[model samples]
Target: DAGVTQSPTHLIKTRGQQVTLRCSPKSGHDTVSWYQQALGQGPQFIFQYYEEEERQRGNFPDRFSGHQFPNYSSELNVNALLLGDSALYLCASSLFGTLAGGQETQYFGPGTRLLVL
Candidate 1:
């Protein structure tokens, strides 16, 4: 069974350019969440999608958005990216209908590292 996977392990771009990262959730999972992890900080939740609808979103601006497909795969898109956007974009999967101990213990994938110049 496949767990989770991401593409383009590393990327470099200039400010104002857009970037798209991909993710495939573990088998038998139905929910996907996107997170941004800065250099010395914990991962911050961006948004979560369940049943193809956005269930919860964090304080991130509109520039951070994502989508989930019927196959439980997801894609995170950032528009007009800024230099501050440079960070590790992590994709996590979990079961939506039920919460894990009141907190989701997300299974993560090797994030796509983003660097902005």
Candidate 2:
């Protein structure tokens, strides 16, 4: 029953470069969501994937994209990255349609820290 896992625990890149972050969901979880958390800010939703398709997205620009595989693993990609894009990219997993009575819990990964110079 491993929880969500992310790759490249830390990364450094320059503006305009591209970066890809990976995540593996917990057992029996079908949905994967990505979030960005700045140094002192709470996590902000980037997007969510279910059944290998993107189901929801946040206010992020088109530079941010993602994909989910059949095995419930996911990837987050950011193109033409900006300095402001530096943050901790987090991955969360949960079962879709299990939010009974508005109670749903998501298990999160340690996150990949990206630094843009």
Candidate 3:
């Protein structure tokens, strides 16, 4: 019955470095999505994974990638990171079927704070 959980509550990296964030979905949830929230900006969708496959992606560049495991946990990896990548990375979980009707509510993790210098 636990809600979504993310690792590394905070991180610090230099430009061009790489970082990986992790997440564990809530019980009964089968889909995982990643989002990036820059300071003062709303969260931007990065990608979503289901059935251990990427189901959808957002406007993010190829540097942003993710993977879903059989247990429904997920990981978000950012490569060649830039200063702009500094933000709060959030992980969300929800039932895929509920999304079809546009009524699904995603439960979000506390988020990992990334600071790129």
Candidate 4:
């Protein structure tokens, strides 16, 4: 089956602009997680959604927001973007497939490359 997928494999935006990135989880997975990875750093969790509700979030600013649709697809929106927002945005899928929901493993997508000028 296809793993997680993200739109606009690459994007470029100016500072203060707003951008929205989309993600579709793997089939059978109902949870989605967004992460941001700087050029030289590991991926940092931005937020997570399950059942169309935001179940968890990381230490990201309000400018970084997201939503999960009933279909388990997700979108990450960044407003008033700054150069610091440039990074590789990754989406991971997990759980809601087999067994009861408890511990789960996440499979990450290739990620969308975003650049803020």
Global local distance difference test of model 1 = 0.88
TM-score of each: 0.93, 0.94, 0.94, 0.93
lDDT of each: 0.88, 0.92, 0.92, 0.92
Give the lDDT ranking, best first: 2, 3, 4, 1
Which pairs of residues collide in candidate 2? none
| Per-residue accuracy of model 4 over 24-112 as CA lDDT, tens digit each | 99999989999999999999999889889887789999999999999999999999999999999999999845555332889899999
Model 3 worst lDDT run, 10 consecutive residues:
96-105
Q: Candidate 2: list runs displaced more than 4 Å.
A: 98-103
Off by over 4 Å in 4: 96-103
Error of 4 at 33 (Å): 0.3
Q: Is candidate 1 or candidate 4 better by lDDT?
A: 4
lDDT score of model 3? 0.92
Task: Show model 3 residue runs off by greater than 4 Å.
Answer: 98-103
Supply the TM-score for candidate 2. Answer: 0.94
How do the residues 1-117 of candidate 1 rate in per-residue lDDT, one tens digit apiece? Answer: 988899879999999999999999988888899899999999999998888888889999998888999898999999898999999999999887555422356799999999999
